[model samples]
Target: MSVTNSFDQLATLRAVLLATPLFAVGLTLAAYLLGICVFQRLGRPTWLPAILVAALMLAAVLSLTGIPYQEYQQGAAWLTVLLGPATVALGMPLYQQLPRIRELWRPLLFSLPLAAGLAVIYALGIAWLLGASPTILASLAAKSVTAPIAIGITQQLGGSVALLMGALLITGVAAIAFVSLLARWMGIRDERIIGFALGLNGHALGTVRAFEIGPTAGAFASLGMSLTGVLTALLLPLAWRLLTLAGMSVGS
Candidate 1:
C-alpha cells in the first residue's frame, strides 16, 4: 500500500508540473543557476558567460524534449515583462554617474548619433550584401537596440520578431566577446568607454556585463543603451523609408 501511495504521489507531482507554468519557470531558473555555477567553476571565462551557458542548456533541453518554443515562451514571457522595470532601475546608477556624464557630454553627444547610425547602416549593409530579403534586412536593422524598442522597430519594418530575437542574442554575445578582446588589444582601460561601447552594441547583455565590472560602468552602459534604443527607434524607420523612396531595393 505504501509503495502504491508513493507512486501515486509522484504521478500527481508530474501532472502538476506539466499543467502549470511553474515547470518552465523552474527550468529556466535551474538552468541559469547551473550556468552560474559552471561560470564560476570555469574561472569566469569571458567566452563562457553565464547567460550563454543558460541559453545552451535551455536549447538542449527543449531540443531533447521536442518542446515547441511557443509553449516555453508562454511562461518565459513573464520574465520578459520585467525587463522594463529592470531597465528603469538603471536610472539610479545613471544618477550616480551624473557628474561624469556632464563632463563627457560633448564627446558623448557627438558619438551617440554616429554610433547609432553606423549600427543600423552596417547591419543593413551586410545583410543586403548577402542578398538577404527585405524582411530579413528589416529584422537585422534594429539588432543593436534594446528588446522593447527593437520589437517596435521590427514590427514597423515588417520584420520577423523571432528572427530579431535571435539576432539580438547573437549580437549581444558577439559584442561582448569582440569588445573584450579589442579593449585589451587597444589598451583601452577606462571602464566607462568599454561599458558605453558594450551597451551601445550589445544592449541588455552588455549592460549586465558592465554591471559586473562596476557601478560606474553599469551607469554608463545604461545611458548608452537608452540613447541607442531611442535614436535607432526614432531614425531607422525614417532612413529606411527614404532609401525605399529612392528605389534602393533590398533584394525582395
Candidate 2:
C-alpha cells in the first residue's frame, strides 16, 4: 500500500472506532472520573460538585464532536437502566430510620405533599407565569424527581427528553450547592427538616447532599425524595390533564 493510503486508513479507523456505543459510554465514565479527580485535587468545593463538573465536560465532548444525541443515548442508556435498582436500594436507608419516620409521620404527611407540589409549582408555574412555551412547562413539571422517573414522566407528558435532562441536572446541582446556604438563611437547624428540604427539592442529588450532612438527614432525605417523586409523578399528570381540559395545553 502507498504511504498516503496507510495514513488514510488510520484516520478512517480512528473515526469508526470513536463512533461505537462502548466509546460513548467510556466517554461518559471518563468525564465523570475526570470531574472527581479534579474535585479531589481541588479539595471538593461546593461550587464544583463532581457531577456538574462531569456534565460540563461531557457537554464539551458532545459539542466538539458534533455527535447526535441519539448516538450518545445509545451508550448512556446503560447508565439509565440502573436507575430502577438504585431507587429500590433507597428503601434500605428508609428502613433504618423507621422509628424516626413513625415519630414524625404526622408532619411528614402534611409536608411531603406540599414538597412535591411546590417543586412542580415553583418550576412549571413560574415558567407558565413568565409565558414559557407549553413544552417548557411540561418539561419542568418533573424537574424535582430523580432522573429516571423524571425522564419517564417527561416522555409520557410529551416533553422533550433533552429539556428534561437539562432541567434535572440544573435542579440537582442547585439543590446541592444552595441547600446549606438556604437552610442557614431560613433558620432551619433541624436535620430532618434539612433532609426533607434536600430530598423534596433535589431528589437523588439532594439525598447525596443529605448523606454528606449526616446519616439521619440522609434517611430523611431518602424518604423525602421518594415521597416527593411519587407525589410529583401522580399529581403532575393529573394537573396537566386538568390544564389540558381547560384548554391550556400547548401543542408539542
Across residues 1-252, which tens digit of lDDT does each residue of candidate 2 receive? 699998788768756856676887888889999999998889977656788889999989888867677778876787888887898798987999899889999999997887677777778768988999988888888999988788889988889988888888889888877888888888989898899889888888788888888988999999988888777788788888888877744544
Q: What's model 2's overall lDDT? A: 0.84
Q: Mark the regions of model 2 whose C-alpha exceeds 4 Å error after superposition.
A: 1-15, 18-20, 248-252
Per-residue alpha-carbon lDDT of model 1 for 160-224, expressed as tens digits? 98899889988888888898999999999898999999999999999999999988888999999
lDDT for 228 in candidate 1 is 97
Q: Indicate the residue-level lDDT of 14 in model 1.
A: 57
For each candidate in the order shown, give its overall lDDT on alpha carbons: 0.89, 0.84
By lDDT, the best candidate is 1
| Total clashing pairs for each candidate | 0, 0
